[model samples]
Target: MASTTAFIDVPESPDRIWQLIGGFGSLPDWLPYIPESELSEGGRVRRLTNQDGGVIVERLQAFDHTARSYSYAIEQAPFPVTGYLSTLSVHPVPGQTAAARVEWSGSFTPVGVSDADAEELFHGIYTDGLAALLKTAQGWRG
Candidate 1:
């Protein structure tokens, strides 16, 4: 399995960052490719309006507030892939740092793609996606 990790530093508290990333349904606001996303746990699901004007679904595998981390997988990711496990985490930097950085890492098995190509695709997806999201998210003061 190949994996990619990307991080974004936001000028906000961990709580604020968590409030955003934790709300899986709001991912489309920053994550470009995913125009819409939803999170379901227990019996409720929060849906986000997708970038495609449609919708994307997600299932929360695990969420731990106190630990500042969560894991999820796309129900219908619009990609040539399967078994995608995505995880995000937030935490305070060193001392007196009022900023929070969001980092994510995940990997999946290629469906009709070669391992080398899949690896390269995912690498670009994760890094570029994270950078863009970080920029957009930081600009969002609301």
Candidate 2:
């Protein structure tokens, strides 16, 4: 399996960051590429609509609200990977009461692609997503 992890430190508390992104179906709230999300299967599955109108279906695999972390697996998507499992988490930055670290990590088997290429793709996605999240959080009043 191939894996990639991307993280960003934002000027926000861990609790605030978690409140923004801890939900299983909250991608649209922080990730601009995902403009819409629909939850099904009693909120265990999420159908996301990308900016290009592509549909991506994912199932929540695990969640730990106390830890401010959640994991999900892709059920259907246009990416050239399978068995995709990803986790998003918020962590407190030691000695930084107004700062937090947000991590996006994933592992998957490449399909019709090299492992390097797959990693690059996901790393870019995670990087861009975190940047957007930072922007959104910066604009948030609470």
Candidate 3:
């Protein structure tokens, strides 16, 4: 399986960051490429529409507010991937009262694409997502 992980430091409390991104259907709020999101299955499923008109459906596998983390599996996506599982987590930095680290990681098998290309695609997506989250967190702080 190809895997990708990305991290970003945000000037916000871990709890605050979790409050911003913890919801299963909150991608459209911080993910720049996501234009909108809809939740169903009693908030266990999320459908995200991207800026390029691509749609991805994901199912929440796990969530822990106290742990500040969540995991999801992709049910449908535009990418050439299968068995995709991803986790997003927030951790408060030690000794940093108002700083936190956010991580997004995913593992999947490439379907019709090269493994390297698939890894690159996911890495780019995570990088863009983390950057957007950091920017928004900064704006909230400002």
Best by TM-score: 2
What is the C-alpha lDDT profile of model 2 across 75-132, one tens digit per residue?
A: 9999999999999999998889899999999999999999999999999999999999
- What is candidate 3's lDDT per residue for 26-62, written digit by digit as tens? 8888888897999999999999989988889999999
Which stretch of 10 consecutive residues in model 1 shows the poorest summed lDDT? 42-51
lDDT assessment of candidate 1: 0.71
| Model 3 regions lying over 4 Å from their true place | none
Cand. 3 Cα-lDDT? 0.92
State the lDDT at 20 in candidate 1.
70
Model 2 lDDT at residue 124: 98
Please give, for residues 1-142, the per-residue lDDT of candidate 1 as tens digits: 5567777677778887787767556666667777755555652354545556765466777889887888877667566678878788887865647788778888778789876777777778777776876677668765
Better of 1 and 3 by lDDT: 3
Give Cα distance to truth, residue 51, candidate 2, Å: 0.6
Predictions in order: lDDT: 0.71, 0.95, 0.92
lDDT order, best first, reads 2, 3, 1
Candidate 2, position 63, lDDT: 94
What TM-score does model 3 achieve against the real structure? 0.96
Assess the local accuracy of residue 142 in candidate 1 as a C-alpha lDDT between 0 and 100.
Answer: 59
User: What are the models' TM-scores?
Assistant: 0.75, 0.97, 0.96
